[model samples]
Target: MTNLDFLLPKSSPTDLRSIVWPRPMTVLVTAPHPDDFDAIGVTLKYLKNQGHDIHALVAETGSGIDKVYGAGMTQEEKRQLRVREQTGSLRFFGLPDQNFRFLNLNNAPDDQVVDDEANRLFLEKLIRQIHPDLLFMPHGNDSNRAHRDMANMMKAIASKVEWPIALLFNSDVKTIGMKKDFYVGFDEADAQWKAQLLRYHDSQHQRNLRDRKYGFDDRVLMLNRKTATELGIREPYAASFEIDIL
Candidate 1:
C-alpha cells in the first residue's frame, strides 16, 4: 500500500477548482523545510480558494535534516524519503510539482543560515522572477536559525528591490513568538493536507519532541492548531503574517 494512503484519500473525480479558475492573485510563500507547507497548508488552501495564484518556494531541499535530525537514517535515505513524502503531500494541496520549487540553499553546518553575497544575489533574482503582489515567509520570531535566516533574506530582498508587496509570516513548532497581523481561514481538506505533509518528515517526528508513535505529531499538531487558533477567526487553519510597509 502507498505510505500516505491512510492519511490522504485519492482525488475526487471533480474538484471545486473549475469554479475558482482565473484566480486573481500573485502570491509567493517561502518555506525552510519540505513539510512547512503542511504547517501552513490550511492557509495555502484558503488563498487558493480565494482565487489567489499562489507560488510556493521552499528554500532548501533539506540535506542538513538527515545530518542533524535524521541521525538514524542515512543521508541518502532521509533525502529520498523526504522528497517522496513532500511530493505526495504537495499533490494533496492540488499544487503541481512545478509550484513546489525547491532551492538548493542549506543551513550552515554550524547552524547559521549565512546571508552572504551568493545568498543576496539569489534573493534578488528570485524576487525579480516572482514579482509577487504578496510575499510570505517565516517570521523572525522563529527560534530556528535557518528560518530566521530566510526571513532576513526576505527583508534583504525587499530592501534591494524596494519591494512594496505585503509580507506575511508563518511559524513552525521549533519556531515561536509570532503574532498574527492577518489570517486566512482554511477548511477540513486543508487540515488533512497538513497531516499528510507532516507525515512526510518521518525523521523529524521520530525525536522526543513530538509523539513516540506519531513521532513529531504532538509538536506539529500543537504548532498547527495553536497557530490556526491565534487567527481569531473560525477558519479550520490560518497562515499568519507581519507586514512591513517600507
Candidate 2:
C-alpha cells in the first residue's frame, strides 16, 4: 500500500510547473463575474509568466451590484461600471486590453444568467476561435448560480465535439465540493501584490468590506490562506484547482 500521510504536513514550494501543460499553449480563463479572475490570481500569474497565450472571457457585467449601488442608472451605465472595474483590474495585472473580452450576455433582473441556446452558441464560437490548450473556470459544484451556469455552458460545449483541451476547475468560497489536484503557492510579496490587484475592483472591495467587515482582498486571501494551511504551508497563501480533460 502507498504510504498515505493524510495527517502529515506536506512541505513545498507549491510549484505547478509539473502539472501545467508542458509547452507554451493558448489558455482561456472564463470568469462568471468580473472579479472572479482574481480568485485564481496566483495560478493565472504563473501561467502568464510561463509564456502561455491567455485570454479571459468574462461572462457577465455583475449588474446586481449596480441594482444595489446605482439605483437609477441605465442598463448600459450599470454594465459599463462593471466593465471599467474588471478592465482596470486586468490592466493592473499587466493583462493587455486585447487579451480579455466581455461576453455581455443579457442577464436576468435578479442577476442570474439564463442558460439558453443563444448563450451556449456564443460561448462555443468563442471557445472554437480561441482553441486553447487549457481552459480554466469555476467548478460546477458551487453555491453560486452564475459559476454553476458557466461550468454547465462549458460542459455543454465540450460535449458537442472531441475537444483537445485540458479543463482546470478552480475553487472559491462558494465552491461546494472540489478535489484539489494541483496548486500554486505564493509568499508575502506575491500576496501583497495580489491584494493590490484585487483592489482595482473597488466596488467589490467596498461591498465585501460592508457586508463581511473585510475588504475583497481579505476575503480572497482568507481562502488562499486556508488552502495553504490545509496543504501544510506554515504561513503563506496558495490557490488550488482540479484538472480534467475534455
Candidate 3:
C-alpha cells in the first residue's frame, strides 16, 4: 500500500466543495513579491474562468532580487524587470493592466523591519476601495519572512475592517507546513497555463537554477500533485487553501 493509503482513510473521501463562493464575486490575490503569484496561479485562473472579477496586488517592488540573485543590476533595474514580468504574466492570465496594483515598498534586509504602518495603510486603502468578497493571500506560516509578514498584515487589516469577506490562505513554496481546508483541482489545460505563467518570471527562474533549488514549474506541479493526492482527488493537480470567514 502507498503512503497516502496509510495517511488517508480506507473509505472513499468526501468531495468537500464547501468553499465554493457564489458566481461573479470579486477576488483580490496578494503577493509579497512579483513571482509569488505562482503559488495561486492555478486557482486564480479557475476563478477568472468562472467570470469572477479578479485583481492582482503585489505589495513589494521586489528590489532585493539583486542581493538574492546576482549583483550585476541595480535595485531599481531589478524592480523594473520584475514589474514588467509581473505585468506580462497577469496579462497572459487575461487580467488587464488596470486590474493590477503595485505598492513600491522597499524590501528590507533580514535583520531589519519594513514600515508596518505604511504597509498597513496601503493594504487598508486597497481593501476599502476594491472591497473584494474573496481574498487570497500567503499562508501565515510561510518560511519566507516577507510572505509571513504580509499574511499577518492582511489578517490584521481584515479584523479592523467591518466588511464581511472570505479569507483564503494559499500555500507558498517556501512554506514548510500547511493546514489545507480545501483543494482546487485543475485540468491539463489549466495546469499547462499555470506552468506557462510561471515562466514569465524569468529572473526568478534563473535564480532558482543558480541557487540549485527546484525549478518553479516542477515545484508548483509537485505541490499541486501532492495536495491532490492527499485530498483523494482523482485528478493529479490542484492548489490547496485554508479558508476563514472574516
- The model with the greatest lDDT is 2
Q: Please give the RMSD of candidate 3 to the true structure.
A: 6.7
Per-residue accuracy of model 3 over 211-240 as CA lDDT, tens digit each = 657666776788888778878777878787
Ranking by TM-score: 2, 3, 1
Of 1 and 2, the candidate ranking higher by TM-score: 2
- Candidate that scores best on TM-score: 2
Whole-model lDDT for model 2 versus the true structure? Answer: 0.78
TM-score of 2: 0.88
Q: Which residue pairs in model 3 clash with each other?
A: none
Model 2 scores worst on lDDT over the 10 consecutive residues at: 1-10
Off by over 4 Å in 1: 1-23, 61-77, 110-113, 185-189, 208-214, 227-239
Local accuracy of candidate 2 as per-residue lDDT tens digits, 105-183:
7565656565778889888898888887678899999988888888888877866754566677887989997988777
Counted clashes in each candidate structure: 3, 0, 0
Assess the local accuracy of residue 66 in candidate 2 as a C-alpha lDDT between 0 and 100.
Answer: 32
**RMSD each, Å:** 10.0, 5.2, 6.7
